[model samples]
Target: MHIHPLITDSESLKSLCDRLAQSDFVAVDTEFMRENSYWPELCLIQIGNREEAAAVDPKADGIDLTPLLDLMVDNEDVLKVFHAGGQDIEIVYNLTGKTPHPLFDTQIAAMALGLGEQVGYSNLVESLVGKTLDKGARFTDWARRPLDKRQIDYAIGDVTHLATLFPKMLERLRRTGRGDWLDEEMERLADPSNYENEADLAWKRVRISSRKADVLGRLKALAAWRENEAKAKNLPRGRIMKDETLADVASHPPAGQEGLARVRGLSPAWGGNDIGGRLMAALAAAKPLPADEMPGREERGPGLGKEGALVADLLKLLLKIRAREGNVAARLIAKSEELEMLAAGRREGLSILTGWRFDEFGRDALDLVEGRLAFAVKGGKLMMTRTEHSQ
Candidate 1:
C-alpha cells in the first residue's frame, strides 16, 4: 500500500527488466499533463510487478527508460495490465518511440466481461478489489518538483490495483468465451497508430447540443487554432482556451472585438490577447453552409419519436433487465448508438449478431425488434415480455 520509488538509472532499469522477465504480467499506469502541448506531458510512470509497485520519475535528469521500454516492446509473455490504457499507452509510445506489445486493458475487458465502457479506475477498483483509492490529489500538477506524499500515494494506487483486477477480469472473460474479443480490444489499445491525433478530423469531436452554424465555424476555428497553438507553444489546450468557452464563442459568433467581449466563459485577459482576433476571423471566414451540409448536430443520436424509438426503448429496457439478471453492466449489452441504429433500420451491427454479446443479450434485442418480444411496465418497472412463438 506504500508508494515505492524505483531507481531509473541504467543499471536499476536493467534490474527492473530482470524482474519483469520472470513475471507473467505487470501492472502499469502513468501520470501525465496534456494541458499545454499536442503530445501528453509524461511526468511519472507507476509500474507494479507481483512483488512491489514502483513509481519512476521520468522527468529526473539522466533517468534512462530504454531498458523498461525494451521490456515493454519485446516481452510477449508478460501481459502489461492497465486500466483505461489509452492515454498511458499514448505516453509510452511518445516517450519510447515504440508501442508496447501483448497488452491488456482492464477497462475494455471489464466491458467485454460485462462491466461498463469507459469505466473509471476508482469505480473499477472498488468493484473488483473492494478498495477505495484516495483521489483528492488526482488533479495536482504532477510535473512540478518536490512531489508531495499524497500525489505519490495516488500514483502508486493506479498500478497496484491491476495485479488482482487483471486475473479476475481475465477469468470472467475466459469463462464467457470472450478472451479473443478482449484480445482484439487490447491489441487496439497497444497499437501506436490508434492514438494518432489527426487535427483536421478534430471537428468531429465537437459536441452539437446547443450550437449554431456561426458558432460551429468559430469552434472549428478555435479547434484548429488550438491544435496549431498547442503544437507551437508545447502547451495543453486549456492553457490557450477552455473547450467550454470555445463552444460558447462558436454559438454566439462574436460580432467583433466588442462582440468577443460579450461572450461569457472567457477570461478577461482573453479579449486583449492576439488569439481573440484570430478566433473572430476564423468564424468570419467560414464558408456559409449550403442547405445540404447545414443539418444540425441533433440529427446525430437516436431519435426518440422515430419509428424505432419505441422498439429501441423496449430493447434498452430489455438490456437493462438482462444486465441486472446477469450481474453484468448494461452498457456492455448494447450502447445507445447501436440500439438507436438497430431500431432505425440498421440491424447488421447489433452486438446480438456478433460474438459473445450476441449470445448474452443481442439475441433478445433482435427478438424484440423483430416483434418476437414486447415491452410493458409493471408497478413503475419496465420489463420485456416474449410475444413470439418461442424465446
Candidate 2:
C-alpha cells in the first residue's frame, strides 16, 4: 500500500479523503488529549484503505478539515472500520453530531472469533497480521508540535495495519458464517446514545446507593449543573466537583449559598461567589424524581442470595463451556450481571434470551435452570446432557 506524507494542508487532506471515499471501507483511528479537559482535543486523524494510508493533522495551521469530516460522517457508501473505536467515534460525534455510519469494529468482531472481549488494536494486528507493534511512542504527547518520524510512522501504522486486516477478517467471518452475529454488536458501537453526553442523564454515572426521590432529584439537578459548568469552562467534571462530594451534597444539601463554603470539596470563597449562587438555585429547583424513574432494590440485584449465587456460578461455568465450544467470547454472549439477574428469577427482558444468543447459549441456560441439562464427563471431555428433571 502507498503511504502518503503527513497531511498538513487542506488540499492533500481532501485528495486523501476523496481517494479513500472510493473504497468499500476505510480503516480509521485518532490520537487526542483529554486529561485536562472535558472535550477531547483532536491532535491527529489517521485514515486509509488497502490501497493507501495517511495521517491528517487536524491541528495544522489553517488546515480546513471540512472535506475529511464530510467523508467521515456524510459518506454513507464507504464503511468505517476501527478497532476498539469508542473514543474515536465519541470525538467524531462531538465534532459533527454524527458518528461514522455503516461502521465495523474489529475489537467487537474479535469476540465472535474467540480473540477475547475488547481486543486491543495491537493484539488484533498481531493475531491477524502476525507482527508485534512497537511500544516506544505509546504514551507520547500527541498534542506536541513537530511530531517526529517515529510518531508519524507509529500513527500511520495504526490504520495501515487495520486496512490490511479488514478484508481478511471479513473473509474469515464469511467462512465461519458468524458474520450475522456481529450486526447488532456493530450497530451498538455506532449508537448515538453511547456517546451523546446528555447532561440531564449525567447523574446516572455517579454511583450513589440512595433510591430516595428527593436525593435522586438533587443528584440529577446537580449533575446537570456540573456538566454545563464543565462544558462552559472546558474543564474535567471532577475539576469542578468530585463524585463523592457531589453525592454528599445531593444527599444533604446546604441551607443556602453561604453553606457552599462548608462543603468538603468547595473552596471557602465559593460561599460568596456566583458559582455558589448557581448551585443554590439548582438545589432549590430540585424536585422529587418520578416514581417510574426510581430504581427498585430488586432491579440489578443484591437480591441474589447464597443459593442464587450458586446457580449463577454454574451458569457462568456453562457460559465458559459454551463459549469455548463455540470459539466465541463468553462476554459476547451474556454478562455476569445478566446471569445473576437470571438466577434471581427475572427473565422477561434480556438480550441473552433473544435471537442468536438464545439459540447459542440461552436455551441451554434455561435447560440447566429447569433441570433439563447437566454437565457430564464423557471420554475425558466435559459435555452436557439432557436431564429433564425440572426442579
Candidate 3:
C-alpha cells in the first residue's frame, strides 16, 4: 500500500515514464469523467509494474502528455495491459490520435480463459489475487482538484492489482494453448479504427423501434447530426436529444419547427431552439431509403416456424453444455442471434464458424442442426452423442 507522489508536472511524468520504460510490461488504468462531455475527461492515469505504482494528474496545468504518449507508442516491446480497455484505449486514442500497441486486455483474456464475459477488474482481483478493492471513489468527480489520499490510493490500487492479475491470466492462457485466441482478441482491440468515433455510424447506437426504411433514414440522419453537434459543442449526445426523443422523431418525422415542437418527450424550448431547427433540416434532407438499403433487423431464426424455435432452444442447450465443457464464456463464442442464424443454416461470416470458436463449439452446433449429433443423458450428465447415420 505504498502510494507514490502524484505526478503533476512534466518532469515527474517524464521521469516516471522513463523508469517504467525499463519494465517488460506495465499495467495501466484511467479515471475519467464523461457524463456531461462528448469526450471522456481524463483526470487521472495510473501506471504500475511489478514493484511500484504511480498516478499521473492529466488535469494539472501545463503537464505535457507527449512523453507518456511517446513511451506508449515507441516502447513496442513492452506490453500495455488493461482490463476492459475499450474506454481507456478510446481516451488514449482521442488524445494521441493512436491506440497503444502491444495491448493486452485482461477482461478479454478472462473470457478466453473461461472466467466470464467482460469480467470486472474487482472480480478478477478477488478471484485471482485474493483481494477486494475499495470502490468508494468509483463515482467521484475526477476533474476536481486536491483529490484526497483515499481517492489517490483507490486509483493506484486499480493498476497495482492488475500487475498481479496479468501474470496469472497469462499463465492460464498459455496452459490452455489459447494464446492465439487472445492474440486475435488483442488485434481487434489494438486497431485504431475500432476506437474512431465516426458521426455517420452514430445511428447504430440508437434503438429505434420502427423497422420502416423511411423511419430508419430519418433516424440515421438525426443521429448523425446529433453526434456531430455534440462533438463540436463538447456536449453529450443525450444533452442534445434523448434516445427516446430520437426514436419518436424518427417514428413520425417533423416537417418543420411546429411539428417538431409537437413531438412527444421533446421540451418546447428545445424544439423551438436552434437545435430544433437543425433537426427539422436533417429530416428534410433525409432521402427515402430503398427497401434494400433499410436497416436490417436482428434474426430470430429462419421462417421454419415452430421447428425453428425448437432448433433455437436446442442450440441454447448445446451452447451451455459446450461452454461448460470447454471452460469458456458462451456469449464470447456465439451470441443468441448467431445461434439463430446457425439454426437457420446461414453460417457465412459468423464468428463462431471461424478460428478457435469453430473448433470449440461451431462444429458441434452445426452437427446438431444437421441431425448428425444428438444429446443424451449419461451418469446424470447431459452430453452430445453421434447419430448412427453420422457414424
Candidate 4:
C-alpha cells in the first residue's frame, strides 16, 4: 500500500477536490481524539479517490479546511465512504458545519450485509478482504508534530485500502439483491440529530445493574449533574465520574460525605467538593420509598439455575446455524437480549419472524427453539439438521 500526503493548503485542497470531482466515488477516513474533551479532536483526515490515497494534516499552521468542505458539499455524484462513520461525521459537522453529501458507511453496510453490529475495522478487513492491517499506531496522539513515517503509512492505509474494498463489498451487496438496503441505512447517517449529543437522554447510557427506587432517582439526578458538568467544562464524562463509580453511587445512595467516602471509586475531592454537596442535597430532597414498594431487583442465578443451561446452549447453536445459513452477522440478526427474550418464551420482534432479518436468519432460529431442529456431531463439526416438524 502507498501513502500520499496532501498538504493542508487551499491550492492543494483545490487540486484534491478536482480529482475527487472526476471520480465515481472516494473512500475517506479520519483519525481523532476525544479522551480529554467533550468535542472530538480531529487530527488527521484521509481521502482516497480512484488513483491515490492522501493524508491531510489538520494540525498544520494556517491550514484551512474550507476547500475540502466545499468538495464534500459539491460532490453530490461521488459517494463519500467511511468505516464506523458516526464519530467521524460528528468531526465533519464540527469542523465544516456541513455533513458530507452522498455518504456511505461501511460499518452500517457490514451490518446490512450480516457482518454484525459495532464490528471493528480490522475484523472487517480480515474477514472480507483477507488482509491484516497494521495496528501498531492505533493509539498515537495524532495532534503531535513530526508524525512518524509509520504513523503516516498507518493513517493513509485507512482510506487507501477502502478504495479497493468498497467495490468488492458493493458487488457482494448487488449480487445478494441487498443494494437498496445500504441506501436505506445511509439515510439514517444523513440525519444531523443522530450525530448531535442529546443531553436530555444522556442518562440512558449509564448502566445500573440494580438499585433501590430512591437510589435510582438519585442516580438519575447524578447523571443529569454529570452531563451538565461535562458539557460545561468541555471534558469527558469520566473526568466528572466514571460509569462504574456512578453505578456504585446509585446502588449505595450515599446520604452524607461520610457515606460518599465509603463508596469505592468516589474521588475524595469530589466527595467533599461543591458537586458532592449538591449530590447530598439531591438525595435528601428525593422522596424515599418504602422498601416493599421499591422496584424489585432482577433475579440472577447460575446459567443452569434459571432455566436449563442446555436450553441456552441449544439457543446459541440455533442462532449460529441461522446466522451462517443467512450469511448475516449473528448479532445483528438477533442480539443476546432478543435471544434471552425469545428463550424465555416472549416472542415479540424476533427478527427471525418479523422483518428482513427474520426472512434471512430469524425463522430458522425460532424453529430451532421449537425443537423442530436438531444438531448432529458429524465430521467433528456440529451440523444443524432440519427435523420433519421444523417448519
TM-score of each: 0.78, 0.96, 0.93, 0.77
**How does each model score on lDDT?**
0.74, 0.91, 0.86, 0.74
Candidate 4 global CA lDDT score: 0.74
**What lDDT score goes with residue 286 in model 4?**
54
- Per-residue alpha-carbon lDDT of model 2 for 64-99, expressed as tens digits? 999988988899999999988999999999999998
Better of 1 and 4 by lDDT: 4
Provide the lDDT at 259 for model 2: 86
Residue 238 of model 1, lDDT score = 73
Q: Write the per-residue lDDT of candidate 1 for residues 1-391, one digit (tens) a residue.
A: 4345655566766677787778889998888887666678888888887677778888878987877787787888888888778788887777766777888888777776666756887898899889998889989999898787788888887888888788888787788777876655566677777766565445556665554555555566667777777778787777766777767666666557656666676656556678777666666777533455455434586465666687777777787888878767776556788887777667664555787678778888778777887778899977777885655
The alpha-carbon RMSD values of the candidates against the true structure, listed in the order shown, are 4.4, 1.7, 2.0, 4.8
**Residue 378, candidate 1: alpha-carbon lDDT:** 90
Off by over 4 Å in 2: 378-381
Better of 2 and 4 by lDDT: 2
